[model samples]
Target: MWSWVAHRITGFAIFFFLLVHVLDTSLVRVAPETYNAVIGTYKNPIMGIGEAGLVAAIVFHAFNGLRIVLIDFWAKGVKYQKRMFWIVLALFVVTMAGFLPRHLMHVFGGN
Candidate 1:
């Protein structure tokens, strides 16, 4: 029950990010200079931190979704739900930890 609720919440979160992402990208087509400025603004520290959270949300939503699907169709998978949940959690942590720093550095003009 909780997993289902979380799955829906995360799905919506990812979708919201995707919508904003599409709108932001569309600016590139409307004006190159404006797009550059927007990209620069995205480099702001606040946005950089938000990007890290976005990365974590996307990773968790995707992996947990796969786990849900696998368990739904395969009888054998039902028993491994807890195991898969832990694996997904671990992956989420590792992916976010690695991605956040690199993403922050990239957005903040690192080498």
Candidate 2:
């Protein structure tokens, strides 16, 4: 139940992020300087954190989606759904653990 809710929420988040990404990228053609200025604002630590969140969302959504597929297709899928959810979470945690530190250092290094 919670995974379903999280999946839907993350889907919406990713959609909106892509929408904004498209709009901002379009500015590059209409006004390159404006695009540059808009992109420049993301150099701060706050946006870096936001980027991390976005990556986290993407990773979780992907793995959970695979779990959903297995649930739908495999004959034994339903029986092990709960365990699969835990596996999905384990993967999410390990991936984020690997990603967060390097990304945060880059963001906070002020280089």
TM-score between model 2 and native: 0.91
How many backbone overlaps does candidate 1 show?
Answer: 0
> How would you encode candidate 1's per-residue C-alpha lDDT over 1-111 as one tens digit per residue?
666787888889989889988988899898999889887877888988887877777788889998999899989889999898999889888888788777877877755
Cand. 1 Cα-lDDT: 0.85
Cα deviation at 88, candidate 2, in Å, is 0.4
Q: Per-model C-alpha lDDT, please?
A: 0.85, 0.95
Per-candidate TM-scores read 0.87, 0.91
Q: Which pairs clash in the backbone of model 2?
A: none
Task: Supply the global lDDT for candidate 2.
Answer: 0.95
State, as a TM-score between 0 and 1, how close model 1 is to the true structure: 0.87
Best by lDDT: 2
Where in model 1 is the C-alpha error above 4 Å? 108-111
Candidate 1 displacement at residue 62 in angstroms: 0.8
